[model samples]
Target: MTSIVSVRDLKKSYAGGFEALSGVNLEIEKGEILALLGPNGAGKTTLISTICGISIPTSGTVRVGGHDVVTDFRAARNLIGLVPQEINLEPFETVMNTVRFSRGLFGKPRNDALIDQILKDLSLHDKRDSKIMMLSGGMKRRVLIAKALSHEPSILFLDEPTAGVDVELRKDMWDVVAKLKASGVTIILTTHYIEEAEAIADRVGIISKGSILLVEKKEDLMQRMGKKRLRIELSTPISELPQELADRGLEIAADGNALIHDYDTRSDRTGITALLKDLQNAGLKMTDLETQQSSLEDIFVDLVRETS
Candidate 1:
């Protein structure tokens, strides 16, 4: 697939000698949803801003749909729509007017039919005539999305789109995203919600301290860094693991009711058979066994901590 957005050796530094983005390199393919995950002030927004032409990069290059963000700003920016983290809509403007004006600002010809479709798709059609101030927070957020889609940009940047929204609203927004993807829109979102990314993103990127820690296909990343634990529920509570099994990295639960063993799934030998045999030899009986896999949140926290 051809890349719609590309970054190479991207660097950004402030006058105070603080780096917001450090040697960042990334590529977003056409028609893919890529989620950028990071802690507060981890450079996710900075990178997005540079790509969208809202902020200039101190160094490096960003291209959107074959147009250079710096040299061909107009062409690059025209192909993208950005829904910022803050809701900065005109308080007095009606939803319909706001969306229509956004399209006009992009020099698009008047198209009421297209505007109506955008509002309806975002579930804002009912609120089209309502003033921005009269709409609830969730409705306002939907208007923001409607406005971003007004000009029919190929790439959409959603910065914390579901932040502060209720559960129902969040689910609604996810559905909106799914419909947009089905229509062939490329989405790049920055979110603190790990599960949201885990549920929606085709690929996930972890950023920390102004650098991208890792970017991989969601399932592949999980399979590679994710670990599984075998929990053996002993029939007889053991105070301590026997010396014979001390070589194995076994953790005794604080309650002393179960034994937890961590093993690499990628390994050829899990040693489960040997461990069970050794447990029986040590006079330990397991009543039941269960395995738990690490989630995306687990891998994210560990990666950030490792970089820190």
Candidate 2:
């Protein structure tokens, strides 16, 4: 995969001497969905701003489609479309005019046909002539996306695009994202929703303390850090574990009806045999068994805690 966007030793600092980004290095492949995961003030937004030429970097370099962001701002910025976190739009303007104006900003010729398609893709075709003030919050969000796509940039940056959005709206947003990627648009998004990142991203990047902590394929990251949980359900509920079972790595469920044992999938010996024999010896009958893997949220929390 060719690199569509490149960052090397990127750093950003304010006059107060607070650093927002520190020696960050990253590469975004062409036509891939990269989800950036981080807590508040973690430099996710700052990185996106710098890459899109909205902010100047204190040091280091960023290249979009082989154009330096600092030296050639217009070329680099022209290849990028940014959907900011805030919903800022002209309330008095119709959706069609709003989207059309954005296209003109990029010196694009008036193409109502392209603008209409963009609106339809965002499910806003019927509301094209409706004033922005007449639309709902969710519809306002779709208009933002339509405006971003109006210029037809090769890359799109979505900063908390689904924040405060309803469940149905979130689902619809991701479906639109899938279609965008299929059309060869490289997307970089900052989202606090771990499940959304896990679902839509081809790759996941974790950022903390103004640095890139980790970036890897979603499946690979989950498999590497994920733990398998063995659930041993008992025929009868027990208030407490036997003294003999206290030393083992087992926790009682909230209902006291099942014992939970977590083990590494890569481990050669899971200790299941010994635990089962001990349970039987203690007169605890195992009526059923179940298993599950850790979710991305579990791994994210653990990673941040370790780094902090």
The TM-score, computed over Cα atoms with residue i paired to residue i, of candidate 1 is 0.85
Q: Using lDDT as the measure, which candidate wins? A: 2
Model 1 off-target regions past 4 Å? 224-226, 231-292
| Alpha-carbon RMSD, candidate 2 | 5.4
Instruction: Report the Cα RMSD per candidate.
Output: 4.4, 5.4
**Each model's TM-score?**
0.85, 0.83
Which ten-residue region of model 1 has the weakest summed lDDT? 219-228
Instruction: Give, for candidate 2, the lowest lDDT window spanning 10 residues.
Output: 219-228
Cα lDDT of candidate 2 equals 0.93
Clashes of each: 0, 0
Candidate lDDT (C-alpha), each? 0.91, 0.93
For residue 176, what is the lDDT in candidate 2?
Answer: 91
1-308: candidate 1 lDDT, tens digit per residue: 99999999999998899999999999999999999999999999899999998888999999999999999998998999999899989999999999999998888998989989988888788888999999999999889898888899999999999999999889889988888898999999999999889888999999999999998998897675567899999987888889999998999988899999999887799999999999999888889999988888888999999999
